[model samples]
Target: MRRDPKSTTVRRTPWPEGAERALGTPLQPSVVYTAADPDALDRIYDDGAPGFTYAREAHPNAEVLAAKIDRLEGAEGGIVLGSGMAAATAVMMGLLKAGDHVIGADQLYGRSLRMLAEDLPRLGIATTLADACDASAIEAAIRSETRLILIEIVSNPTLRVADLERIAALCRERDILLAVDNTFTTPRAIRPFEHGADLVIHSVTKLLAGHSDATLGYVAARDPELRERLRVTAITLGLTASPFDCWLAERGLFTFELRYDRAEENAAALAAHLAGLEGVQVLYPGRSDHPQHDRAAALLGTRFGNMVTFQIEGERDAANALVRAAGQIGFAPTLGDVSTTLSHPATSSHRALTPEARAALGITEGTFRVSVGVEPVETLCAEFEAAIRAAQA
Candidate 1:
């Protein structure tokens, strides 16, 4: 067994100062590794002495970013994956087995809902969907077979905050592992483990990476045993993050605080502005009107996250028109980028689920998600106002 770089007894060389600056460097995507050099090969994988066995198994780029994330997340270890779904699936599959049950939030990432509703069942894993906002609902959903409880710190599409501390405590009492997706409230805003969550997951593709350039995910666990299991599952399933994508993710992390700082301010200001406007139904974690506003305030404080969603007063066509009208906004599924990106969940991110399923989660056709960027609040407000007016017209 190889020693982790961070292990105190490892006696490893110290990382250079400004090592953090390396994260944002553009990735050299075409770097090739060859096994022909015997000396290099020996150094790379001597008796599993520590370090890369293959690019798939490990990469300096990925490890570097993972290290930073682990620090930010306050976790024993973290594993990066190809996507958020990969991260979720790896954690669940690695930790839970056949006949084991999972209690997951009803308002999870659409792909996650599908994974639980459609895929996990086929594998003989049972799941019960509960409203994460209600700790009692989660408690009720947990069966004797339940081994994992999954919740999102801030749900996707709908910017709702979960009662993670209470729920995590409940899971701990019941001896079940708790996993919270911290995608919306990136580690910079709040570290979920501090609130008792056993494992924290991130769609690095979203806020952690803080750019539209990379597709990556991560799982940070409090316990070393669980973290190792996640890593093993990732290695076996080939759910590893690409070195280049990891590099890009790292780059995104460097400016994460700055980006989110701007985006958060923008989101709050925009949310307030939207709430005051007539006929727009806004959903923002920052607002006191949010369903779990008090809880969000208690946990995340001033940073309620960058995601802001609202519904146009009109129907689906009108909403689609509004999306099209926002010409500066990228009409894509990605989030947490420097450039404001918009997504229509029913058609993009949640397209995998059925209409009924989406409706169940309050994800309507008119629901528009905005990953607030560093754009001036006034500019973004203007774009939104113009789009809404166009949709109404």
Candidate 2:
């Protein structure tokens, strides 16, 4: 008689066997794994069992990290990669073939836009850039060859919130795959899977890691077939994340809830203060003055995220000076650090776009992107105030 597939009586060996043990999953940094017998190794490889054969294909640490993230995002399975761009590349290469077309958000991370606009075309894949916030625009841009729709949950620098649910519905009607970049909002703020997103990508270097140290990314999908395809592509491209970094990211995941709560509080207080300051135009999803504030509230609920973008009244020099005067803050190109950091879009994140394009997107030289950290609200406000005063002087 055949056993019931759903039976919970399946026998399993105790983990770690004997001798080697750990309260947490121990870091396995070995570049290659081995089995007691050659035939056993061949069986493991042929069966595609859960044992690691090579670091590039899979490993214990990366598996642990991926599992935690998969649970958080409500995905059937997921894979971690060397960087966020690598994850995006794997998704595009795995799911899309030559002659396929992709529809992307007009406002995206600068590098992502570059890939869709320049790189994908070179590979015989066509792409159309549309305003994801406008469902009609996306619908109009779709073609018969369209295979995927790419969007960011909360757009970079500008903080525009996409209508994910509406877009997902549109994608379903067209039988197109919907891929969401959830780096900015994170699973803690909003799980795109809950909104019908087929695939969710996150730059683990950002909020998931909670510190600026780890360089990692992950792609999660509700379909096991999609997840497996992405994993194979990641392995083929040699985009696997370092096991050490994966271990560190897992540690960071433990404190994500606490860190995110504090950071959100800091962002709210700082955004409110900045809005009232002289010569400052603050753009935060939490603020009702923002263009997509209502949408953000509905999708993200109470957590509005830790990013706030504002423009100083003067020129680029004034913005630079203000950043310099903020003695405690670091001017870094990246976000989601433990301490409050500032980034200038014109010279950093959005530098790839032409001047005309940047202008069209409303990202001027005076614009500054703030990655709010877990700092005291009063301290952050005081430092920003002093910096503004110095910039005006």
Candidate 3:
């Protein structure tokens, strides 16, 4: 007798005998999987066996991608999630309790600052904001209840490089945890784990998935025990990433180093040229005039980074004019793309910040942040110069 047509269509097929293996990891989009024995299913549910029962809890794509990120970061263990913010949320939810205290930089990614200042407090967790660039400021803000100190390696917009070595020592002395948001620097620039950070976090949506298609995030924990807690928390909260997005991110990683190197070199050249513009003031760590030049030189690898910020002279209107004229460089609200793009801090990334806070951080209406990308150096230089002239006109 022949099998029913419905069963024939739905049943999984077996591969041919001695078939060649796929050169790359095949995308597994199966949401729910089965096991032969009921006892085996229970073991998988308990994480006693490395098999997937549910996509949200555990999936092959996420596992493989997480492993690669683990190797890159030199982490004890790691997890992948839906978005960068989800990764940050998982860290706080998994590790922090109601009474635990966290010390974070005021200049962290805008959304993270909002979470520290507003969201976490709702959970009865208290967070203190400090100037992470100043190790003294971070020390002064530390309390006996402080459980973690979180800061970006290179701050957004302003690009202040934190003194990780000093802060890591302080965390060690006080037995406090150190978490570095390394989205900007990535592991390519500096892996925070080697500098004594207990947790290395990244917004994989940006550089790791350099083409700007994937919205993924990662958190690498140095302690095995902590890793399990985070993994469980992420799974329970339904923050796990989709198989397709994880697959895209994996593809992006293959050429990440090449894109990063070229983009960084382009940024250095652009910053140098923009520095000489009549009225613009460039904020690049590679430049001697930058406040954190020495620290960036000491701490960062090869070049400064792919970000270059400059204030357009005159007013916001001048900045607007420049954006209008720079037809080649797309005006985007995001960063870390294959082609160069410009983002406005006052209106986009740092919009949540109040006027006073923005001004204090040197983020003005005229501030133009260029997310320098893997474009030809000569084209970037000429186009940006023309945009400046148009803004002045």
lDDT of each: 0.83, 0.90, 0.89
Q: What tens digits encode model 2's per-residue C-alpha lDDT throughout 1-393?
A: 887876655754345567755788677788987677887788887986568788999988998999999888888678999989999999999999999999999999999999999999999999999998889999999999999999997898899989888899999999999999999999888888889899999899998897888999999877888988998899998998999899999999999989889999999999999999888899999999999889999998888999999887777778778888997898899998888998988899889999899988889988889999998899999998898888777
For all predicted structures, in order, the TM-scores are: 0.89, 0.94, 0.96
Q: Give the winner by lDDT: 2 or 3.
A: 2
RMSD values for the candidates in order, in angstroms, are 7.7, 7.9, 1.7
TM-score of 3: 0.96
In model 3, the clashing pairs are none
How do these models rank on lDDT, best leading?
2, 3, 1
Worst 10 residues of 1 by lDDT: 23-32
Per-residue lDDT tens digits for candidate 1, residues 307-326, read 89998766788977897899
Predicted structure 3: clash tally: 0
Q: What is the lDDT of residue 146 in candidate 2?
A: 99
Clashes of 1: 1
The best candidate by TM-score is 3
Pairs of colliding residues, candidate 2:
none
By lDDT, is 1 or 3 better? Answer: 3
| Residue 85 displacement in candidate 3 (angstroms) | 0.6
lDDT of 1 at 211: 67
